[model samples]
Target chain A: MSTYDPNVAPKVSNKPIIWSLFAAGGTVTALLTPVLVLLFALAVPLGILPAEMFSYARMESLLASPLIRLVVFGILFLSLWHTAHRMRITVHDFGLRSDGAAVFVFYGLAAIATIVLAVALI
Target chain B: MSTKTSILPVVGSHHRTLEVEVLRYDPDKDDKPYYQTYQVPCEEEWVILDVINYIKDNLDRTLSYRWSCHMAVCGSCGMMVNGEPTLTCASFVRDMPAKIRVEPLENFPVARDLIVDMDSFVEKLSSVKPYIIAADERTVEDGTFTQLPAQLADYMSYTHCINCLLCYAACPQVNLNEGFVGPAALALAHRYNLDSRDKGRSVREDVVASNAGIWECSFVGACSEVCPKHVDPAAAIQQIKIAATGDYFINFLMPWKKSKNTDEASSGGGK
Candidate 1:
């Protein structure tokens, strides 16, 4: 065997992926909350819809709609992608090698989370 | 054949050797710095400091250097090994081939040999008020404060700094601007400020407000890269900037009320 070793390469981890997922989720939630609140206020002033109708029931119903479902899926996919990228960085920062097993595991988890979220929304 | 007994040669008989050139400076005798060379035997496990020690012990007893703890701790043996800021004790000589160069830590006045004056580093450390301050001072009868694990995790990594000046040596900003507090000191300051039990925001006002504070860091990130402890001085400075920006807004809105209240309290006490 040659003296040169391939095992010395760095590895990535899952923590950064998890952190990025949470950060993206929080940011979207923050932005959407204010915009949704403002839209509800405007709807009441415009008299196109009743203010009280914008409740939990309306939100659940909206999620069941195809258009809303598509938006939700887009957000979830973006958040998961951001998370996976971040996790790779976090793993590398801790001096872990980016071995095939680590990459497989991280990508697998991100894929699973995204699929699960999409199914639930559907 | 019967007259001579068979003997085996040493396994490392053909091992490589290197010529190491080290910069020498003496304030008392030498008008300027000069280079000295030594031929050292190379082994995979040998670090630069090991070669220096060998040269000092066997070649020349008069040659001076500084070292402690041999490991990466104590931060006493930081020097430029082959133009890189490195802990001499931990830098392996075998990594370099044929030639090696060594010099004292940069961004400081060289006192003699490989030692640099550390007065500037100490002064910067003191400038940041690197300690916790409670909003209310408690008497001796009061018990010690407590903190949660999550709170401790915020600043725990920064506390690992062994005061190695490697970050300062690597930081070009510190080199250009002597007034800047540098990386290690700022990281330590962040350590205290981030403590959940510490209510010392008021004390850090002047430090963060000063031009020498976190503003001097241009996010070159060389400090974090050269840091042996992985303290991430760049991250600490960024977090401080976030807090300072928030504080600026709060001060602008409600400055007069607090100032007037303090003035009234002091005047009443004087009466």
Candidate 2:
């Protein structure tokens, strides 16, 4: 019969929206890396900063700090999610011909990355 | 003596068969739309439009649809094929299973069976001033005007639009808002404004300022996906948004300058 029913709603996918979030996260992460580098370049070199700033101890200590921890966690989480989203789209765009397997692999990687990052940070 | 050559049955007569269900509506007769199915013999290479044409020519002469340039260039045969906005000429019948559903383009008011009222699209096309407005109209007579290839590339892809309106069908924003100028027209506007020889910045002022223009597009990318011509109207609209934003500021700073340039150019025999 007629496929042109008014009630037939168009299907909307979450992939593009998720990818957009990933792009935004990637942009922020990119900006944050430079800002972090600049902050260290300007602030740490001065005698006013802690001498441990150059050592692994400083890195661990910064990771333990609440503000730095929060920022790092957010960046790691968003970037991993973004990577997963983009990887899925890349698979689709390349015509992998296995939607189920592609989804499984992408989400699996994302979940594993999220868990690893979260556990390490927390 | 003449030798009679016997012709064998047509090639691919037994490969596959498709049940095509087409939307039928006669404005002069039927107030409500309905569907009629026809069993069509098709080869692997036969497209959905071919089946429809066969049904029209054989099964029912009363049945109506639209198509031209079966190779897909004319863009006159866009419709919903199996719930997707597709160019009928390009959609192969073999791609579907046992059944195929064909209907008029979505998000447009159906005037009849497979025909939709295109007045709104035409009006929007006109609103964009889809034409070149040369900076020096008289310079053309003197053969002083020419555009570089790179400059032409800026809007070259946008000009390839065949007025398919598939972008409009795929755009949810257009479906939600009837007032929206949709993607095709905005893309056309972008094409003209990007022309190096064109000086129609003012012509597009209202369109860009309107709620229906580029502001309505949410960049769903569906429009580009369904476009058979690879027009990428969504990208054109996005680039136009950037241009509009820049023009908003530039015009504020030099309100008199643009008008003065236009006036001087016109007075100097350039339209």
Candidate 3:
């Protein structure tokens, strides 16, 4: 009680890094995921495009390039990270206080999935 | 030759009796706070504050609260009207239902009936050093500094915070974290930090950039909605997040540039 200075500031935390990634992931998912969904899921089935517009052969041709493979992987990685961070925040908002456990579990899943996807792509 | 128009109730034409339920507590008398109802004869054009005054005058003298400057400028009449933080002076009695529930602002200790203890709020306000801190003190002989209208416009809107604390009540982050500097204070901090004449961004950054500061805010945006003055503390906090992120990267890549300046905020350089 004697030495408590409320104004005495602590060192800046490392949350900026996490927040930056979360923000980037949020933007990437928001801008690209809807288009990806519309093209890959709804467009062909709803008769907006032909049935064989996104055939396995066409998919193979598109993924033939390493650059396109890297771009797809990058989007998937960011979207996964975004979902991981969102889940953690949503859990906290739902009145659960186990932030440490949530971070470990959520971010651990994202990291494990990223590695698995990377190896499969290889 | 006065041409002012009066909106007072003519005779008994526009009189409505309202059952106002107010949360009451007496520290010396009661162990816990409870509701006390007042049957108030509300006028046609009376705001919520006028209804409280009517109760105080005609119904209950013991009902205590804070008010001054009958306008919203005083910011003393902030309370929860139907679970929303409201400036009673600005909210019309006609807008509410027949039954009104009034309570002290949330996230603060109740001092008395409809009055909250503002000690913690005052402490938080001062922690940000809400003032222009220049590199050197200038005497009267130094004359006045000139600021362009464009520069003034940058931080003009933020200067309108009346310390009503509606933002504090509306924000869930404040309710959860006592250490986190609430909206009004952080908005004020940003107000000063944006001042071109100020040079103490580094001094303020120790507290402002901490975990309990703007980083604690998750951009729920409740503060912006509840702000009566439209000061937009949420926006201020988010802007600070961007600047702090820049500072974080700058500090990481070049530790020598740790001392941040107000003028060179790396904040896109304009309003």
Candidate 4:
């Protein structure tokens, strides 16, 4: 058991890990999100690509590679973490008090989504 | 018969009446603060401070506020003009609407009419040791510390802070957290830290790297926008954050190669 000492320096916040993830996710989204949106939403529906090319079997086969699975997980997990952190800060900026409930709701959702997506990919 | 036409003066070229609303309070007399309006006959080019002086000199001698060196260099005339923090000496009457609301700077306790208590601000500014700290003692017999043009340019932008404290009024985080070191003080700390001649980074780190220091700032960016001297205190705070983050990780990874003052800073006392 440790007693409280007023003289000790305040514990440094461990925000760098979440901040780094947010930065990486932001970079990934900036470079890849628009292209992904164009391909799946615009190109597929506008007859620019044959529908058979994006069939279920073909998509499953494309994602079956170990390298592709790793990339998918990286993008999905990092983006969720980024959005969670962003929403938490945004809520605080909008004059809402940040508390344990808000933290649990936002970061907890990101944690759960990461676990579920990891299992599905496996 | 030719009739002589009567000449009339132009409408707005002469003086105009400005409805100036000032928040007035006296700790000795009033139970709470209240707004007092004065109809000021203002010239087109007159600034808000001139109008306040007019009220003090003529209408009500009891009106109180701080101002000197009617120019913006003094930095004593900061107030809330029309819901925005501004230097009364720099805010022109011509640019404002006919009716203007003037109040004490936000996030500070009002001492009088428009004068806010600045003891906390002074304390914070001093805590960072906002001055040059050399590793070794220097003598006048030694030549003056000379700096190259490029080196001087590195921290020149942050040296423009006049301490008007408009950034403090604009920062929401400061309003929320009373102990947050605020903008001008942190920026001045960063300014000294960036100086080529100053080796006081280790000494100043105790305050700037403290939890109540740069780490508390959430990058509102309003401080930079409202800065009359274009000091960009927000940018200074961000740069300090990067440095602090690097220091945090470096200290964690290489504990044996730690810098001096690490033990002192760990004691949670300001030098």
lDDT leader: 3
Candidate 1 Cα errors over 4 Å, as ranges:
A1-122, B1-15, B257-271
For model 3, how does the per-residue alpha-carbon lDDT over B1-271 read when each residue is reduced to its tens digit?
7454765445445568888999999999999999998888887778999999988988889999999988889899999999999999999988989999999999999999999999988987888889888768989998887787878888899999999999999998778766678789889999988887777666777777787788778889999998889999999999888887877888889887776453475322533
Of 2 and 3, which scores higher on lDDT?
3
List the global CA lDDT of all models.
0.70, 0.73, 0.84, 0.82
Query: Candidates sorted by lDDT, descending order?
Result: 3, 4, 2, 1
lDDT by residue (B175-217, candidate 4, tens digit) is 8777778899999988877777777766676677776787667
lDDT, candidate 4, A22-122, per-residue tens: 76787788888999888889998998988898899998999989889989999988899989978877776676876456679999999999999999886
Worst-scoring 10-residue span by lDDT in model 2 chain B: B261-270
lDDT of 1 by residue, B1-271 (tens): 5554536433344356778888898989999999988887765567788788878888878777778899988889898887788888877765776898888988888998888899878877877778876657877787876666777787799898888799999987777666667889888888877776666554664554345676656567888998888899988886666565545544557876422212211111221
Angstrom error at residue B262, model 4: 11
lDDT of model 3 at residue B141?
Answer: 98
Ranking by DockQ: 3, 4, 2, 1
Question: Which of candidates 3 and 4 reaches a greater lDDT?
Answer: 3
Return the interface RMSD of model 3: 5.0
DockQ of each: 0.02, 0.04, 0.38, 0.23
Scored against the native two-chain complex, candidate 1 gets a DockQ of 0.02
True contacts kept of 1: 0.00
DockQ of 3: 0.38
TM-score of each: 0.62, 0.66, 0.91, 0.83
* Ten-residue region with minimum lDDT total, candidate 1 chain A: A1-10
Interface RMSD of each: 19.1, 12.8, 5.0, 6.6
